[model samples]
Target: MIGAPMETKGLNANRESKPNRSRKEIIEKKKAMDALLKAASAEKDHLSAFPAFRRYQTNGLSAFLESGRGDKLASSVKHYIQNLLKANMEGLYGSEWPVEERVKRREMVAPEARYIFVREASNASASEMSTMSEQESTSASCVEKRGPMVGFVHFRFVIEEELPVLYVYELQLEPHVQGKGLGKFLMQLIELIARKNQMGAVVLTVHRSNSVAMNFYLSKMRYGLRRVMKFFAKHSVMRLKLSWRYVSVSTRNHLRRFIWFNKVVNSTLFTKGQNPAIEVLEWIIQFQQNALIIVI
Candidate 1:
């Protein structure tokens, strides 16, 4: 799945009529894709000690989780969804989650900001999506052991606005399925989701220090860096967009406006730390004053 995009990109790049593609650019892109493919096959090393997604069972208000790692990615994901629904409902019917809770909930449960990959597998012997409902799928299947219980992802909407623009919420693989280029294959699965859904983009946020993730997103997948924030865990927001490649004039202008707003807001917000630029100039002057250490 993850490997699918590399193949597609290679073909697309080949057919492109652009005359200014530098030899260096082509080499770099190929190298990046190769690395992505390799990582897609890695049996697991520096990555999270275990699987990226898992499952959980709840008894009343208390929830029990099971994940490859202690973090219980699946349980966390479920809780996250609950939080969003809570937020949405609270908005209309006298809230419960306060501001702090809202932020915490977002950190726990929001759909990924960016996703380099996604996979949408229908039940091999399927019914039409519209005719079947969420409950029907859950009731029909025995909680697909081949992959994570992707009940939420399988739901359909007539519009893209209803879904997260960009995200890679989870990556689940069975042991035998581990490595051997399946990750890339899974990513292609996601790409189809983004493209077919008519999403303007796909995005994922990773810890700033998560070099492997950052490399996969920015280098291999060609997702653009969108935001860098110090949210408890510093993270880089990245996006895969079809817009920048061929956006409308109005859209481009709106982006220009956003850039202007960002500059003004960020300049004001980043004004702390005593102006290092001024501090540097002061230090230079101080050095000049001390240079003529004459006893006059």
Candidate 2:
């Protein structure tokens, strides 16, 4: 009888400690996330850690990279991002563009947004500025003689699914710069940034109608689809006429806003000491993968 009481007391003690332990774990996790974010944001230049990747000169294209924040971007650059994204993606959305544009405008200026801009390079030391009036008064040591902006990548380090990740919001390039391997190079750089920051993976969303971009990502970039589903199905927006047939208005609209979530292949899949970007490129030749697509 005495031993039974002691065992019952011990069971009660464990039952009482479980909640405390769980609570402690939650608190520790939150602290770790905050610390990781703080460390990443504290760095002035993520690219500085990889100098070789700062300049991409290959396949008849020459460009250098510079970093900026959306909120700190010069007015001209903001206009440029708006114009470039519209030129590249407007047709894919059709009637949903105006609303999508509004959303993009707001998102572009969020404080957390980070940008990596590609500028034309004339030589290793300097860039040749173009006619665009996007000149910003930055320190000479940071950026010098920045050339015409040919492309830009917008990404953020965020916690997703309880794991830290770098989410690519936009990867826009001027039409002239397309097909020159710049996009693939930018994605590779993005993956490196994710890895350097200790992120679990890299994530991005794409439009289903943009088949060329879709193929480029899956067939060339080796980004795997993480999920596919409907988003904002209950929400309605103004409708417009279209020449296409065989689909209801809501379905058409939903399809118009369909989003695909693409994630870099899990890092663990790669062998140790091998370059992840190169490995990803090698994987592309053998498979056609599907990325996550969401209907919004």
Candidate 3:
């Protein structure tokens, strides 16, 4: 036993069973990663996130963008992007912080940004079909860091029965871009667009796990009408159906158009060119003040 090499316990383990060392550890890590992925789904397409997602895990999609117009329950996620620029949720070292916030603190966050607008058909009534996949529609809008896309809130609307049923696509904000109330602002901005377009009410969907978004949408009491119901068995979809009255151009009659969100949230938002959905959210928040307090 004198010459007996001090068997490297872990090294021996690796030598004999490197590939099968720890199933328990592997499973737990997998679960943690899945939850992280689920939590970070909204930010899958961030500019800084691209390299990390691609090289770190080799997991990503081509739809990946620096940023794009987000879901249209009435919002401009561009606002979300701007706010995320200051999300002070974390730091880089000593302790792990939100990937984006840490990136922001050091000024390492990619200034690389893009806006995905709801590319609506110029004329939905046109004779041409937009997509071959059973009328699956798409949108195209200018991408700008400056303000060419000002005044008008670029929105995406789908016309049904000659009435525009707006499409609220999913939102993606990188971990580097969380916090700073961009989420709420995005919701309000979308409603602003809906108010302007003379389109029907706004409709959007939130995943069950996305408590942050659900809470924001639920914050609008008027928005939680039948459209914002628990109707879906597994997931929930909120539809904001508006009357022709709300879509009026005067913008003064704007608040009057809000049949549901009326007197809810910030009814003051009913003012000209204001986002009626914000009032709805306010209303919803008031109805269930404690509801929003408690995480779903």
Residues 1-296, candidate 3, lDDT per residue (tens digit)? 54444556656766868546556645654465344333333342332322221111011201111234233212344444444433422221114334434443232222322134222122321223312122121223212212112111222344322233333433434442335343444455555544444434455433334456545566643354232233234333333432112222211111221212221222322223223434434445556541212111
- Counting only residues 3 or more apart in sequence or on different chains, how many pairs clash (N, Cα, C under 3 Å) in candidate 1? 23
Predicted candidate 1, C-alpha RMSD: 21.4
Q: How far is each candidate from the true structure, as Cα RMSD in Å?
A: 21.4, 9.9, 21.8
Query: How do these models rank on TM-score, best leading?
Result: 2, 3, 1
- Per-residue lDDT of 49-72 in model 2, one digit per residue for the tens? 766677776777777787888678
Task: List TM-score per model, in order.
Answer: 0.28, 0.73, 0.29
Task: Give one digit per residue, the lDDT tens place, for model 1 in 1-296.
Answer: 99999999998888774544555655654465344334433322111232232112112111111212112246755464454445333442244335534553443433322222122333441323334433443333523412322222211111111122324433433333333444444454445544443332343334344354456555555544433222223222222221111111211111211110000001111112233422322333445421111010
Candidate 3, residue 232: lDDT: 30
TM-score of 2: 0.73
Off by over 4 Å in 3: 1-155, 160-162, 220-222, 225-296
| Cα lDDT listed for each candidate | 0.32, 0.67, 0.33
- Runs in model 1 deviating more than 4 A are 1-164, 169-180, 226-296
